[model samples]
Target: MSLGGKISKDSALEPRIAAIDLFCGVGGLTRGLERAGIDVKLGVDIDSACEYPYLANNDAAFLLKSVADLEVVDLTSKLSGAEYTLLAGCAPCQPFSTYQQKSGPTDERWHLLGHFERLAGELNPDFITMENVPNLARQSVFTKFVTELEALNFHVTYGVVNCAEFGVPQQRQRLVLLASKLGPIALLRTKTKRKTVRQAIGGLPPIEAGEAYDSDPLHQASELSNLNKRRIRASVPGGTWRDWNQELVAECHKRETGKTYPGVYGRMEWDQPAPTMTTQYFGFGNGRFGHPEQDRAISLREGAILQSFPKSYKFVRKGDPIYCKTIGRLIGNAVPVKLAEAIGKSIVAHVASHSGPRKRQLNDWHD
Candidate 1:
């Protein structure tokens, strides 16, 4: 399947693969799956904020409900007319992420995966898939989820996949899982080139620090502090804080522990994929978010594009103020749209070849 262009439709004779995107933050996965010709019936997420973007860019219903509260009937009702069902999601991955290891299963959100597993068991969809931080593979809940799918006789394949290899312009690593009762399913790689930061955002018009482009508010970059401006000036593409003049470095960097942290206040390289986009990507001190040649950090629009969202993708109404925290979290936590599209295409191919009487039996769960 192709990336970064118009949505492509599969032949009409294929079994119609309809889906429900649980934890569909900002609709990244939904948009990608739609591009690969999946009929996403509705997206279920607890964030009321996700509603606008989820409904805006994708032709699907947005249900503002926790996955824990989503009864099987809710998804079945939405997917009733579907010929084949695909239950797809990425439960919020904080508890399992390396960056936030202190948050364990005691964190209420950790059980969201368990809820997903429960729903998967009850729904028995023809296919199931999830995207999450790669660290999730080490957790017991993941083990249980996989074992249960195997118990259901679903063929499952999962592993850590580099986002750049799948056309996302960021070097984000995610654990992707695919389960199908149709046959031995796998996440075959796309026939595409590794994407780079330059390919993703090189076409955008330039803007100064704190300047919102005249016509595009999402293109606005955060204003840098006077000190940060000087620091960025001293930085080179893909270089670390060590490149800055000694006086330009922060006292924190002088600390023994901070000496090991080279990614902070760094610049992204134009020829390579960018460091993973974080919630603070708009701030110059937050990781290597600096625009490769530009003096400012990447704009919100640029970050979204790196996540493989089309430049025209809408996050809010035209007059709305772009709240960085909310939108950043939405983009940072999203399953890269390009990766989702690749997975969707793989699923479509597997179904086209492997679908048989077993697919009909699994669809019986919807009745």
Candidate 2:
């Protein structure tokens, strides 16, 4: 057999599995599934920002289209001939995110999940999964979502999981729901000790203010405003506005309302897990965005690491636009690859136990 033919034949008998990543921003979830032995066949997203990272890092095709415009038949064409189809996605959660709360059915973003439900109804995939901000569980939309899955006769498990517990190295909590027509499904094994920031980023090459890493573009920091640079100098690691000298503080920060939100403009402590990374993580005034000990803000790469992407995972193509906003959106929007990988492994384990023992080894397949 030709080399290509041999591999293709080998793959078919090797417990072949395939997944479609919906809202596959930068393919973080897909990256995790690939780590857990599932082939990511394709990805779909509304933003062009996701195309390069999703396609370049994972060997998958990217469809730059909104889920709202598409339907189950569209997915059928994409899958074409795959044996096992896993419908997986995370609806954009900004409308329901704790960071920005604007609820009710009138919120247009809530309808996207309904679109996801529409696919589940028509495709009836063997497996389905989704992740979102933890508060989603409390919303009526979430209740409706659960109702739809159960009505379709799929066994479902949903919970709020701390991503840090799964070695994400960031203080982020998300709602994860896994549903299966096969049988009962659960999340990846619960995490034990949480991984810390030092464990995740301490070993990276150190960079000074306004400098990028020689080896990694993501590790470079944006140039600081001269006044902000001085303010940062007075800031202590793990300290908030209380650490700033009176003269160094921003006038807006001196206001009464600003005093209540001290976590903003604070530096991370080297030994702790980082606070949740936001879309504005590249900006100094957003959240506890300062680097743990570095005088400058955290680099795009640092944000990626906090989101649990592997160091080798490439976000931008060789000649693609390198705007910070684009990079930030990709990193901020990803479901941490580590968390996704864990979930994938858990799903596989559940599948394995229910099904008869296979002839081929599964761990090697995953590895």
Candidate 3:
């Protein structure tokens, strides 16, 4: 029943788990699950933008289709003979994001989770996992989702997990939920200390404005407009708009109303974890995105690395113009790979405790 292949007797505690990553942007979840010893059979996403990276980086087959149009049968087809099936999905959370809190349910992408619920009911995989912005846990639809899983007699564990505590370098917090039909379920243990920005990005080679680093695809920076280039020059590390000169300030910033909220137009401090990464992380005007010392925004590769993807994580082809809109959506929309790995490890521990042991040593299963 082992996935990929049978586990050796010494590593017998390993479970033969097969997983499907829904809304699998660039296979972050799939990569993490694989790292935690789960076999990722396929990844499903509506955005063809995810197809290249998803396929190039992992063994999972990438299905470029909207979750709304997916059927339980289609998903099952990918795991026809596998045992211990696990269905994992992280619906697009922009609608539930803090930035969109004022927009309410008016955001159209909010309904994508319903598709996950529907497929879960039909396929009835042994385990289910989902991750989203913490704000989602407070929504009525999220409440209903929990209630439905409870009614199905599944043992469910849901909570907001700080990504930094799980070794992700950024201070991103996500609501992670796990439900299992087999006995009880829970999350993995958090690392005792959180990781910081310097510890994570300190080792990468430095790059100049509007440039990419050698030997790293994820370290490329965004193109700067003439006006933004000038604005960024005035921004200081961990400091906000107050650092800008009056003439260079935007009209919006000049208004007394803009004086009240000052988290924008700031630079990240090297000693602390970086501000929560947003879609515009490559744009200096967005959040505390300026390099700690350099007068430029964090590069695309740095943002991706902070999100816990490998240095080689492919976003666009090597020669492409690095479409900001496309890469931003991919980065901002991803479930940080480190967080996903933690969730996967938790599930593996849960299944191992309930399912039994093998012939090989437990540590051997780590690979």
Candidate 4:
């Protein structure tokens, strides 16, 4: 209910750079933007579950509405008092990710990016950015979105970038797009620090499978099946499923078709980055989410840490019970905080390089 930033008269005259995070799940992108020195004034998402975390960790207003339902007038007041505005988000990915089937369920999420495009076209903010699964770059909607931005005179650039290279301690790759009405804008390929799984979560105290550490509520691991318990014990760090005994091999892996899937039921290597953190990352069978030395799947907090979220980042209010399924989805779907921070830094540097006198700022906002 609290809109963190008030639209004051004097500040309105010299408005700061403000951003609205559309489809902002748990404030990942908003936090990163704030860290990169941008004032993200608002975050909007449809999920009621995301409200607590989004508001708790961010100094921004939370709007629990789908981007499809938004209009220019709806955002006029909310996005007020910004001399330079940015609209940033990663629309839901199930509709476009490789993990999701191309056909079946129908939902508004499929066209969420289209709605985002509509807002961008209508609001005409100074800058815009979107992050999503790499496959999204191959879709027609993405093509049309970029084409329309170019038509609107935006200097647009987009491509798939490896998240590990950008400071995230996971082997996740994502497509990133940056468009600016000012001048040419591109993601800064700075070759920053690359983190390993050990550097990120190695220091946390060991917790057994199905055990929740009271010291950190989010540091709870999911219960492994009796058979999975034995499977994980036999697993060596960075080893594949083939390392398991003949009786321990899954039924699917026995088939010729499933032989290629050596990535599952594996432990992470202490010196290397982890596999991509999926929504079911807390389940050992879901992916190579098992602990490097422990016998359990990586905990929810560990997954968040691999995604570059700080250890102290709050996902639920104190005294609130934790649900791994919902929290995992929020963490998996979130943009890596480090990647978002890099994107924000790129934009801020781009804008700072072209900044002119305060008197000409408003008039020079556009190309």
- In terms of lDDT, the best-performing candidate is 1
Model 4 weakest 10-residue run by lDDT: 5-14
RMSD of 1: 2.4
For residues 1-367, could you state the per-residue lDDT of candidate 2 as single tens digits? 2311111222322255667888888888987887777767779999987887777677678888898887665666555455455789999988888767656568788889998988788776768999999888998888998999999888999998889888899999889999986788888667468878888888888897678776677677778888888877777778887787888777787999778888877788888889998888887778788887878888888888889887766777654546888788779989998899888887777777676533323222222
Residue-level lDDT of model 4, residues 1-367, one tens digit each, is 2222222323221235678899999988988887777788778898999999888777788988878888766665665656678889999988887777653227557788889888888777888999999988888888999998898789999989999988999999899999998899999988667799999999998999999898898999999899999999999999988998999999999999999889899999999989999899999998898999999999999999999988878899888999999999999999998999899888888887786513224333332
Q: Write the per-residue lDDT of candidate 3 for residues 211-271, one digit (tens) a residue.
A: 8776765677777788887877777777777777878778887888878757777778877
Superior candidate under TM-score, 1 versus 3: 1
Question: What TM-score quantifies how close candidate 4 is to the native fold?
Answer: 0.92
In model 2, where is the ten-residue run with the lowest total lDDT? 1-10
lDDT of 1 at 100: 92
Q: lDDT tens string, model 1, 256-349?
A: 9889889989889989998999888988898999999999999999999999898878887889888988888898888889899988888888
Taking all chains together, the TM-score of candidate 1 against the true structure is 0.95
Which is better, 3 or 4, measured by TM-score?
4
lDDT of 1 at 203: 89
Cα error of candidate 3 at position 244, Å = 3.5
